[model samples]
Target: MPDIAPQPGVVEALGQIVGARYVIGPGHDQEPYTTDWRGRYHGRAEAVVKPADAEEVAAVVRFCAENGIAVVPQGGNTGMCGAATPSPSGRSVVLRLDRLNRIRWTSRLGDAIAVDAGCILADVQRAAEAVDRLFPLSLGAEGSCQVGGNLSTNAGGTAVLRYGTMRELCLGLEVVLPDGRLLDLMTALRKDSTGYDVKGMFVGAEGTLGIITGAVLKLFPRPRASAVAMAMAEEPEQVLDLLALARTRLGDRLSSFEVMSRRQVEVIAQHMPDVVIPFGLESGWYALVEISDTLAGDALPPMLEAVLGEALEAGLVGDAIVASSEAQAAGLWRIRHSVSESSKAHGYVVSHDSVVPLEKQAEFIRAVEAAIIAAEPSATVVMHGHVGDGNIHVLGILDPARFASAEALRARAAEISLAVDGVLAPLGGAISAEHGIGVSNRERLRRVANPIELELMRHFKAVLDPQGLMNPGKVLPDALPA
Candidate 1:
């Protein structure tokens, strides 16, 4: 924690910008912002500031900068890491962007749209659809997560196989600097010849550099026809052939290709009974693929069938089922959606957001799972993720018999993660794929991050937030925001 607490006039100064009623100080009003979505990281803040607009936001930031109060700019508070959660020092201020939720307008051409940072992802998607366009940043938390948090963390969702992550989906952003200056880099331009892509830096910064307020996002023509299928492979190795076939057959139409381990699907079935697995446990590994195209016709179904039929014949896919209708397609997706939920329901699970080379993905999963189970036989290894893009989420579920308390299990999970990440690193993979390096991954980042790269990040942090007041404890080491 920084050597500072809330000054004498800190609360009064913050209240002046957004009103005392919105400035939550102590008691239950500030409780929600103190903890993360998973309840893994519990922290505290001097106050929670809810500003309705950017003007109020600037003022609040200015006040905080003056008072030496750290700012944790939060959007939906739906992040996995403790990036949004305040630290235990009780000296920082939690600045929430929920009040800034607003959909300004969509361009007539439907290529771009202006959205406030606090806009719910689902609302943004709906707004895009109203004009016959598509906001492709789809995630499980779309109904609750906000756009600002998505960009801040540079979230990678199912569509990253085709559309890309939140960083690529967005074109422009409005960020409030640590010094309380509003840098309006908001533009819908696809091409910009600038000295440095400063806007890009803040996209995945996790609020270490500054607070993201709004963004101009790129939109695509809504897919008129969508085809979804769930296919099983005899082995994880065979799934690679399926991926190559998908690219060759579907090309641009191939939107998402997610692979799930048999254990992951089985756990989902055992825990989440409502989320029906369309294709039962007939094979070792399963894949859920989706193809979206602008062309509107019944031909997509046959084309998908032909692709799967060829794979089936080639011995790449064991068995497959293409959804007959939209409802059926959504049903297939429900199974994919239930992986994380079911994994968490059992007990403390150490989740890893990692990616390996496409050629080594299968090998990585097999090796890591073997290593984990060998270490803890009772641990349920839940594995699945966007196999197309190489981003795989591996979870290590703790066995209650082995560990008496959640703390002990969680500590061991971190140790296992390091061992798992070590295997991933040599194979041209990263420990973190989409989830950024917040406080939760600070230690891992310190261990795995390149010495030069980590130094550069430290320099950037110092240059941006010289006083270390903007989200101090995140995306860095030894700079805890108290």
Candidate 2:
């Protein structure tokens, strides 16, 4: 595909907006900014613009709006899909938000923090913890990802079962509208029954509506004491039974419940040698569960022992091991964190982050496996996810030695995704669960999203970003000409 060029004057116009030092055009300066994390998509951009503050961002957007040039907002570029990268056509400018990084204000009194869009997620977590609070939205890319990207995607992580997604954790936002107007509505208040709750329209809009400058995030009290356990299960079904038992016994204290298949465990053990497993025995599936002690000086050992005992007697759990100390707990988490890295070691794979209703969680995983096997007899499917929220990361593995062509493997994976979508259609599940619908899943969104909901989305985008200059070709399908 040929690169898309903008009007002859777009580059010069942008240069005037943010100054020459901040604006980078084609050549060595722009080469490093062209690719994404997964190496799935690559495209050239006319220039990479770094705006230091909201004013510069607004100026750039206004210039693009006036010149009819499309703008693609990019932060950290840690997104799985090519949502952050410019399209193959080298016409658009990549508006990089890394320079906007800053910690504006944080309140220990009400458990809220205000941070710039470019602030790294890990930094935010540390800042919150410094004040004896927790910012629990965690993922594999937390170290490099930014708050803007999280809010834009409404990211969900292991803590979502307890703290909720980024949407729930967020209390306010400050955005730069498409036409260069600033929407300064960053109120860190909890209750405001004022009007339409307009701030929400851009929360998960995936940068289609506007460029998010900063946000106020809700925080929670840090867990006093934490316990981690690993349990073996006969199948995914047994895992569900174990969850019911744990919930009934542990109540709201359950912090994490991650389910992994035997295939996932085998790969992790093989690829990541540093991560140690307590037992040598194998099982059909496994769950790495965690609970937090809310009360001060509370004894967590007895509570954990009681739940494991009941799980064993009922045959819902096969075998279990609780972490003896904090060091052991970190080791268990390392195993869970290495899942994606292990899959990469196997060969080319297609990763899907989707969520089904909790009640049908086990059935959903089984159906995906069966459906993929039925569709492609040679395909190998490995499943792992935050089972507490019914969100599974289904990976289709293809041995590079057997299938030398990466393109062929990706094609097969896309077919499997289509089949998975067919299964999820009736269940009202999400195609892009934690990962937002970037350029990769835009078409799928059109196919699976409810029509009325999509209409509302389109109308809102049209109103806020009428010029279509904010992250064009993302979150929404290309607009049809009248």
Candidate 3:
């Protein structure tokens, strides 16, 4: 750990703002906030302050700004990238929003729900369900990940095929600006011909521009009938064909279309023996298809079955199993949800969250796989993602023994990432689909993004956070030499 020199009275001052019991000084207790969820990035903070509400958060930010201490805003600390982790410089304070968790209200009339930034994603979903509505932003980390973190990353999960990303799911935001001023834009209105979308800027800013304190999120009618199926295919093209077929047959009811490589499913099966894979891993690729309807009936299952039946007859699908019960549907989803945990247990994974055009997805995957193999032959590459939205998550697992050190492994991972980017560039795909450019891809984003785009981002960052105190070293890259 780096020697973190605490500024005189800084800890005491923070303790006063948000009760001494809520303020955790540097040491073992601060470990959880300092280290990222992946354990990839270890950082050091002078103190971790848990603010009770948005006002307390603003006060803490103001104090930090006055003292010239970097403030790293954290929520749940479930981010894959090191966005929430403080820098190892130790010249910073971690502002944790976990204590600010609260569901302010659920407006069925407005079709929206207002929540504190620290509210867990699952809690938000349940709160929406309480009112017979649906909060559709979900992923493996929904149980622990906070709404603010999801908003920061503009997360895209399985349901993105139907509901869209977090950006679209959110209606408005309540942010604490760098200067400690609360900027409230929490509106539930679906239509607003507002000039310059200020809230949208913070949606995917990754806490660079401001700290997201609360949000008004859009809600939808809960699905009364749903069907889930695990379909096997010989190749990526076949999976794409099935996606097209599903869309043509089910239309808006096609909620999720997830693709997983054979290795991805096998890893889940190996690590999570309790989770059952509906179909054996005989095929090269598998897709988890889900269709949902607001109306209650037995029609959903038959509709899903008909789609799969046609695909199977057309040679697009090899074999398929539709979940006959709610328990069965949950079991089928367990396999997809278990992927991240299983992959972590398998080995050091060099993960990529890239999205390509629907037409070029197959080609992009093929070229990227080939490039990865050519770059590192010994690696086991596993692929999966929301195929309906063209987001493909590629994981290259490497043996720890092959690398001499962590630094060596990271270097190799960077090399492989570059190779994947090389393939992605030609396909007109984005380097980052949903995950924002935190520490992991900061430089990569600078290299890949257009000059004008980078310029505009820097301008916005400079205008909002002139001192660069709000979540420093995240999202936007470091300024270039004058």
Candidate 4:
């Protein structure tokens, strides 16, 4: 909580751009914009400006820039960290883009769709499906999360195994810079060897660089036929072996591959009745494999059967179950999605969205789990994530007995993360993975980020926002002021 002076004429200036009715400030109506999704960081904004379109957003940014006011571009406010929240000093304006919700169009030839920043992810998926296309970005927050936040974070969901993250799915973006200049880099074409590729920069910037207003996203032919198989393994290490064998056998047919721990599975089973574990026998770790095809033919079952047979013979998978019906496939996916909610229901936990190189995934998981358990045995460790992409989400729960003083446990968990990240550094893995380096992970960035890269990031931020008017305490480390 550093000191930040309130900029003059902030309310009047923004009120002139977007009507005063849409501008929220210093009142009960503005409370929600002052905090983050997790309720971890509570910020204070001079005003919350809801812009109806890209032009309105541009105007608001222009007014703020002229007055030397800071701006925090927010979407659905569904981010885990306080990346989208404003500062507590009340010097910044919260520019919410929810009013700009729109689906422009879908391109058949290029297999891409244009969407406004405020468009809900689930709605985008439905729009894509209307054109007989599949928007492969599937996450727990799809129903409520806005496309802008997802694009800003370069969100990676279950489908990252085949389709890739938001960075890979995004073709172009329309961004408004800190100085109020708009850069429309919306190229629907896939093969573009253009200069610099500026759109890619804003994808994972976490709104520190600029505000992402809209995007052209990659889409695929809707999967006409698909099969889901739940494979149980005696050990977490065997999940990697299972993935290796499936990748070889399934080839391009693989759609989704996720790994879940026993505790993670049990939590989902207990909380969500609709989502039952496909297999009754309890295993240490499990793999959820999805094989799909675009054409209207049921080739998924046979291919899955062949792969599972090989996996069983190789002693890689302990047990397996291929969903005989579509309802069953949805049930399995439901179980996978419930992991986060169930953990939250239990209590406070230290979550890490870390990733290692694919070949080193199992080894990384084993070493990190052992180290963490050894250090904090009473902690309920719920481990799971997009194993196909090597991103392992490790959640360390606090001891129920030590309910009143959880701060000590949280500090110890962070120390464990530092050690785990240290082990992952040599493998060229990211400590933050798909989740951007918000205020929460800023210090961790300092620890893990290369010094040269850190310097360059600071230099870039200075060049774009010389006065530090954009999201000030994000992405970059706070200790080293730019």
Candidate 5:
């Protein structure tokens, strides 16, 4: 799609809200806002507006609201689902909130932080660590992804096994309503029973409801001592059993239980040689376990050793390696973190982020693999994810030579995604576990989500965004009734 021509005096009105320098358009300066990080989604904005704070954001939004222009609120733009990208229609304006980056308040005793939505996640973590606290949201994109996008997508990362997703980590929020009103709910209160869970409505709404301006995030005490273990297992059941043992033995200390296929390990080995993977390629599966100790003493390593030793007796562990030093532990984590990058390097892949009931995960993977292979025999599955939380990425990597063009590959991607959903739906899993239903999974969401629930979601969308101007054509299959 081509860039939309500017509405008469529209750019001038937006410039008046923030500034002419902030309201930029019509050339090379606007190129950066037109595409996503992955380069898969390309869009064109009428104008890119940089707002510094909620009031400024509201004024910009107010102009878009009055003029019937679509406003796409973007922060960092590190999303995989194209949620932050502008529309292909080129009529919308991009609202960049990066300038609002600020750590408003941090309370060590309260274990809470109030930050602007545009604050980078790693910056928040640094602020917490500076005070001997921990902000437990960690992901590959933490260095670049903004807090607002994390909360908007309810992102789940490696630490989700311990700290939970962004939704659970947040206490309150300050949002700019769709119609340009500021809703200030960024409070430090942990418990509020007065009304509905108002903050949750916008948590995973993908900015369709409003623009998240600021947030109150939960923090934790920093772990004083930690242990990391990488063990080989023959089957998913053995991995599950080993995880059960770790949870029972370590209890609250268990931080992450990541499962990766042997193929994932090989891909990482092939791509990243410096990172040490514990087990050899003899086994088809491996589990990466971590224990975070809050106490001053370093007891976690011995405890993890004891647990893995028990798993060995039970035949749940084939081969194992426990990190003796922090550098070694970081190396093991590097292996786990390299999974997605390695998979992307493999080939054209249709990735899934589905989560089933904990016990049903193995069966779900088996069923989906069986179904996919029966239909498309040449498909290869690369698996890795939070095994403790029942979320597994069952990516189907397609051969480049199979299809003649990119469009054909995408068509095949759609079919493969539906096949995954076929198995996932019957098992009561989500089409999107951590990634919200942006343009990527909105169709699947429409297909599988409860009709009544969808109707209510649309109702809420209409109520919050009466003009249907806030990130139109995202999260919902269709626009609210005009």
Candidate 6:
């Protein structure tokens, strides 16, 4: 929509591969594809092409490769990082895969399903439910996000404590190489010791290696009974104790153990008034615990209640409430899912998705909060995470009117992030847990990652994409000039 000029014959060549109507030119609505979900990054593209299937996608990539133009593969455009957004130079093509939505096949006996990468994540869950199976890769953005993006980011959601991340959930992948070759490795096998894991390289590559067209994902037996409870504690150590108690009592039945600070709950309640927070914001921290079993009966509720009762008796939990009905359970989860939306609406937020060891999580949070306050005394720090897995999301909210310009705010954010990384490094924590390293953390990764690891990543990128036309300036940092 800006005053950038479109490349000569680029749109026409892409249109020939798909169709003229499918290709969005300079005058069309490219904002949706060019901007990320959080509106943090905006880019310009010579054309946005929507291909119908893998063949058309290959053709488009082939054309882009031949022309030496960058090709950015986008799915649902729900990424937190700027992985899918193209550069502002307007010398790239945005290849959207929304039209490739399809469930190719499903096998309940084999516990696998082959689906097009463009399929909505929730749709895949529903399809698995239809076959009496479960696809447990649940997230807040499942309703609109696509499977391809999830795989690309290696997303870990609320249920990751039980089902693992997308890397563990996926069995195989179908990808289009940078040179336009369709590599079909969509096998629904549980174990295949055949050579190196070529498919694994593309799982979290953020479309830098190639564009994922389809996937064969693993499924599990659907849980027939479940119980949800919210417990309040005076401190994070108490929450960690409660997690240990729940796991000891419930064993593998425990599916999710989410911890949220009082500020996090207040943010949700303030923005989403309709969401019911059963317990008021008086405690220092809260934990949302869920346990499930394959047997359908009332036993699960009593088991959860017993666990909470024990935590209370042990002086670990100050207050607790168990959901009495399905609607009530959904309402509790609604509060958790509303955190991101409400935080964005609250103010300019600087967020981090880092993972620390379970024993170090409490200390990690304390140190990061102190660092944020030291950096900006007025910044309100809110925290939450899947404590069972040690992936915590820390956010610092600031008033937009205080900063003179966006660059000023970004500089402050970068300072805070560096302070956070400093705290995490000593405690043996990672800068990124679920979210992949897009442009947002590309430089951070280079600074924090081992030199040999970065070199190997560059080697792989060079071998797979010799021309460096696939999703340039993402994941790995730009190569230094000779």
* Model 6 lDDT per residue over 415-478, tens place: 8888888898889888888888888888778768889998999999999999988899898877
Between 1 and 3, whose TM-score is larger?
A: 3
In model 6, the runs with Cα more than 4 Å from the true position are 479-482
* Residue pairs clashing, model 1: 89-482
Residue 201 of model 2, lDDT score: 81
Estimate the overall C-alpha local distance difference test score of candidate 4.
Answer: 0.83
Which pairs clash (backbone N, Cα, C closer than 3 Å) in model 5?
A: none
| RMSD of every prediction | 2.0, 2.3, 1.5, 2.4, 1.8, 1.5
Show the colliding residue pairs in model 4. Answer: none
- Tens digits of per-residue lDDT, candidate 3, 374-401, equal 8889889999899999999998998989
Per-residue accuracy of model 4 over 1-482 as CA lDDT, tens digit each: 54343456777777888888898877666779978876767877878999888888988988888887788888888887678887777778899988889999998777999999999999999999999899999999899889999998989999998999999999989999988988888779878886888788788888888898999999898988899989989876678888888889888889889988898787777766766666774788988899888877887798899989988998888789899899988988888888878887666666788888888887777787777777677767888899988898987766546744556655776776777677778878888778787877888888888999999888888888787877778888862221
- Tens digits of per-residue lDDT for model 5 on 1-482? 44568888888988888988898875567777868776667777789999989999999998899899899889898887778887667788999989989999999999999999999999999999988999999877788889999999999998898889999999999999988899999888988899899999999999999999999999999999999989998888899999889988888899999988887788778877676666569997889899997797878888999999999999999989999999888888888888767777777767788899988877987898887776567777878989898889888877878888999888888888889989998888888778777778888888889999999998998888878999887889875311
Error of 3 at 307 (Å): 0.8
Of candidates 6 and 1, the better by TM-score: 6
> How many residue pairs in model 1 have overlapping backbones?
1
lDDT of 6 at 366: 93
Q: Candidate 1 — which residues are off by over 4 angstroms?
A: 1-6
What's the residue-level lDDT of 403 in candidate 1? 86
- Give the TM-scores of the predictions, in the order they appear: 0.97, 0.94, 0.98, 0.94, 0.96, 0.98
Pairs of residues at least 3 apart in sequence or in different chains that clash in candidate 3: none
Candidate 2 per-residue C-alpha lDDT over 345-399 given as tens digits, one digit per residue, 9 for 90 to 100: 8766777787888877777788888888876776668889998888988887766
Return whichever of 2 and 3 wins on lDDT.
3
lDDT of each: 0.86, 0.83, 0.90, 0.83, 0.87, 0.90
For model 6 the local lDDT of residue 127 reads: 96
Report the error of model 4 at residue 311, Å.
1.4
Best by lDDT: 6
